[model samples]
Target: MREISLDRLRTLVAIADHGSFAEAARVLNLAPPTVSLHIADLEERVGGLLLSRTRGRVQPSAIGETLIERARRLLADAEQALEDVERQVQGLAGRVRLGASTGVIAQLIPQALETLSQEHAGIDVQVAVLTSQQTLQKLADGSLDIGVIALPQSPVKGLKIKPWRRDPVMAFLPARWACPDIISPAWLAAQPLILNDNSTRLSRQVGEWFATEGPQPTPRIQLNYNDAIKSLVAAGYGATVLPHEASTPAPESRIVMRPLQPSLWRELGIAHRAGEVERSTRHVLEVLWELEAL
Candidate 1:
């Protein structure tokens, strides 16, 4: 049998993903007839049917299913090899996919990306906003090159986990509500609360604190974005808690942050798949450690 062509493999993958020859043609910028012809050619080369077409939908045959799995790996390895070559020639010139939870994306990631861009212009960094759970899933699937996640206990298999920094959680209070000095649990309890969304690691920590400090603390509002929560606090709607770096007071000083008596902190770390490490991923991790130090 003749070796199957890369074009044929790509068309097969595209059809499998789109579930229709017309849709695959649109994706690959080919005529629908051309796409059908490619698949026919591929099937003849392999001496088996690859797809079963009904009226509107398409399903891969058993042989097609097995070949699809192999095709995906081939495509992935091909892309990685290209990236590896670029890395060798250009220091760190390739796509690096990174994810971070919502709050960290606001302050931490922007600063880190700026520093990395300045030092290594060749590296192409793409960031996705993910919850801690979603970040873990993507890392496990090799969809992400690295992630800045809240610390995890046992590292994912074939992945390197490194502690990056500890962020002190602080109260965001309206200027009118800002206490003169340190905020005790009682003081925090006194204000109307704008709490973090329940899924967040910071939210879980804050919930535990609330449970210990004052059970059933009433909430005036809830928000997901760090900036939106700060905006509400500044408007005197209610107070919210987040990491210090996640927010800051206005120059004229309408909002302020005060340390809680018991104090709260969250750990942030970098996770990357274990193997021949990608240059862009290493550059990102190094910048994170530098930021943590300062």
Candidate 2:
């Protein structure tokens, strides 16, 4: 069977509304004979006569009414499909997949998403909390559209990295502890430590900092989440080191934030596929960059 034409369906609906072939042709801007031809073709294909003339007025047969109702719904769906595609083409609507560390997601993504919601309501940024290594790997594999990752990374093939922000890595100590003006590695190492898991770049960076001036300390416990590490510190269980963004909430009363004596910093970078990103992803990237604009 030949595929049904949407144009013929449209013509049928117009004729049903106006109750005259002449008026449908006028609204559709077609010759009256073309309107007749459309119905004749539809009727032949469906194997049914579809219209009746009574008292010099046109009305639909039982089959015509059923076809017209379905035709109206089909026409509405097709119009919506076209509009949806057009919105995506205009970068007004689409979905973008993004990956970042739990800390970054907590500190940064919420504000970015809020701003994006205001500016591009049709764009959605799906976030995954992943380690820096995992974020980079997914970006390379095309599983993710963007990544917020730790810096000093070895270059990966087919990925572009740009500095996003640098934040102070502060020691979050139990307020009960007798702490100095600045926290040195020796001072921090001597205390119980709650550090990020060994799998993380943060763990490696903190290790190198301790090795510089004193014995490298082993953490009492290691966990991936920054908030969990802070909770340990707040409970006076152990001291921890984590990046402190201005937007991050101030330490709780039980926790005291102290700068590292050597001034350690956590640098972050934005990463994406090297070239030809989709416009929807690009729109999301613009909002992400606006978070710090660096």
Candidate 3:
């Protein structure tokens, strides 16, 4: 019996993820032939074909599927072992890159980062601001260690999503807009508005809610930047809608956030590729989970 090498298993996982030798090679920082040779070696050692190749794409056969399942676990365990060793030597020293939707990054990430930094000064954190869709893609590509997103009821395969927190959508009214403290959708529509475009799940929730209320005019301004939308509303460019996190006061007297007479909110969660959890990432996730408890 041949002992499978971590290098070979890693190649298998990458090929399975990317669906092509060329792409997997790119991820592995190897020449395409090198990846092919490794997979061939792995297949020969296993004594069973592990993948089915079509025109250009590759997929796991039944045996390949079995191998992949085990491979992910093996790789995870191996990675964890490396992390544990490093922890002993360096004391939780490592870096993790995270992708976060615009809402959470803008509203909550700073505070959370400060908290993490206080506890684990050795763990370096890098965050990229991305839309939920982009975040999911980055996670799939292994470019991001974790993603914070708003997930739908149905889930994606090969990914693990954990609910982090609930965020409500609230109306941002001009500081001096003489409207009710909490306005109805109809009342909100009566004013000129700049809305966060329908590119995000939270924005779509607001759009659908408005659609259900009856016919309404399109927004005067369609914007993507959360802070810009808030600024516009404060400047009286128009009223805007934002998640409850954004609805919080800006500490300046110029903007006012009021709950909608009928309130709406979006649920947010942290997502990672399904498999062995990295020790460093697991520790960070524990911190987020604690935030939920708080």
Candidate 4:
């Protein structure tokens, strides 16, 4: 059997991702002809055409799609292997890829990272803001070393989960609105509401909260970013429900945050692949756990 080259596999992936040979060449810093040659070499070795070009757009063929999926896993594993070897040889000096939701990234990860940096300057940290579902997918595929995600995540094989923190969901209203110190779900639902969209788990949870109280007013607007929702709320457009961590007031803000009467909370937790862990990854996790303790 003929061996497939990693370089060729990479070229195939770049072309599939970027949608054109020229675009992939630009991203990979290879000549257009060189990119073409790599694909040609791969197709010959695999005995099948890898890509189909149509009307200036390039797409992966059926065989190409299969190869590309496997290639991504291969590349991620190769990169992790290199990082693991480096950590073994040089102590705690390598990259740790961490994934989390926007709220955690905004409120928690930075503080934890600051402490990690002070203690282990040699370790490099990379953070990606992703939904809990996205974070779990990446962790399963070995693209992420650790993920901080909302709790109640569906069981995923090969993942070890642990609690991180819990944040209360608060109602954010215009400061001028006459509201009690503790707001009720019915009151919040009656008011013009700006809500997290259905794309997020928080939105579903919020929807369920409202459902338990019976039929409620529809949201005036739906958005994914907490800051954007806050901006609209500050303008008196509508109220919103957000994690307390993301309810911080800006200097020029006119938003008032209040806890719910029933007190809903979002639970957060960390997940990593089950079994033996890398030293650098474990060190980063220790730092995060310590920060949580404080």
Go through the candidates in order and give the clash count of each: 0, 0, 0, 0
lDDT of 4 by residue, 77-177 (tens): 99999987876556468788999877678768788788888878888889998989999999999999999988887789999999977778888899988
TM-score of each: 0.68, 0.86, 0.67, 0.67
Rank order (by TM-score, best first): 2, 1, 3, 4
Model 2: weakest 10-residue lDDT segment is: 285-294
Model 3 scores worst on lDDT over the 10 consecutive residues at 244-253
Candidate no. 3 TM-score: 0.67
**Residue 204 error for model 3, in Å?**
1.0
Error of 4 at 284 (Å): 1.7
TM-score of 2: 0.86
Computed on alpha carbons, the lDDT of every model, listed in order, comes to 0.81, 0.90, 0.80, 0.85
- Candidate 3 regions with alpha-carbon error over 4 angstroms: 1-85, 88-91, 246-251
Screening candidate 3 with a backbone cut-off below 3 angstroms (N, C-alpha, C), the clashing residue pairs are: none
Model 4 Cα RMSD, 1 decimal = 15.1
Best candidate per TM-score, number?
Answer: 2
Q: List the RMSD of every prediction in angstroms.
A: 12.9, 2.7, 16.0, 15.1
Candidate 2: where is the Cα deviation over 4 Å?
Answer: 31-34, 154-158, 214-216, 274-280
Residue 8 CA displacement from its true place in model 4, Å: 30
